[model samples]
Target: MINSNSRSVAALVALLVATAMPAFAQPPASPAVPAAAVTSDAGVSGTAGSSRDAARARRKANRQLVKRVAAVLARTRGLDSSRILIRAADGTVTLSGTVPDNMQIPLAVNAAQQVAGVTVLRNQLRIGMRME
Candidate 1:
């Protein structure tokens, strides 16, 4: 006659073998994904490419804003823009570097502010002689 402990051991072994059998079995073959559905780069999808393009476009727009502001300052009478440096991001513009005349500082700021697409203006200009 089979003892209770021996029967319990036999049942536990059978349960373990039943559960572990699936781990050794080969998995079912999966359908291949179409080439058009796959992205150029591994682990990256189409959204990453679109976002990269968007970031590039934003940088280009910022550069264009800086050029327009610099042009405006250059065309402004009594304002010397040669010594000034302009930086733009989004709609914000930063005016840095030194101006020969104190009056030209306001002229630069005002002219930059009047230009379209300039939402914020940061004036880092100082009154000093132009270096070199």
Candidate 2:
């Protein structure tokens, strides 16, 4: 007893209602993440990132201080790069090697000490001694 146009309209309405029902009935939910998993992920990045950054900065600063101290020693009176050896451990400077004369020992020590990051200077310069 239904008209052809009426039947088509009813079919379209049914299709529309079927599609709209699911969307209106529920909103999309975020995937459920466990608290432990979230915390572990964050903790890994937290400590590692900060410590890595600090270590990089420290290494860079140490290299710069080494360069500056080496430059000073190279230009110092009676002191040459060959006669000077410098090792820096966490800002403590250790100077080794031989100079032309005994008095050059103090000059080498003073040169290393004046560097900005040099906290300790261990001078092991033995004048008139040669290393082969």
* Model 1 misplaced stretches (Cα beyond 4 Å): 1-44
Task: Please give the lDDT score for candidate 2.
Answer: 0.69
Estimate, for each residue in 46-86, the C-alpha lDDT of model 1 and write its tens digit.
Answer: 76677668778988998999999989999999988997888
Lowest lDDT block of 10, candidate 1: 22-31
Could you tell me how far off, in angstroms, the CA of residue 89 lies in candidate 1 after the best superposition?
0.5
- Predicted candidate 2 versus true structure: per-residue lDDT over 18-110, tens digit per residue: 644544554222233345433447657776667668767876777787788899998887765575666666786767655767778888888
CA lDDT of 2 in candidate 1?
68
Q: Which of the numbered candidates is closest to the native, going by highest TM-score?
A: 1
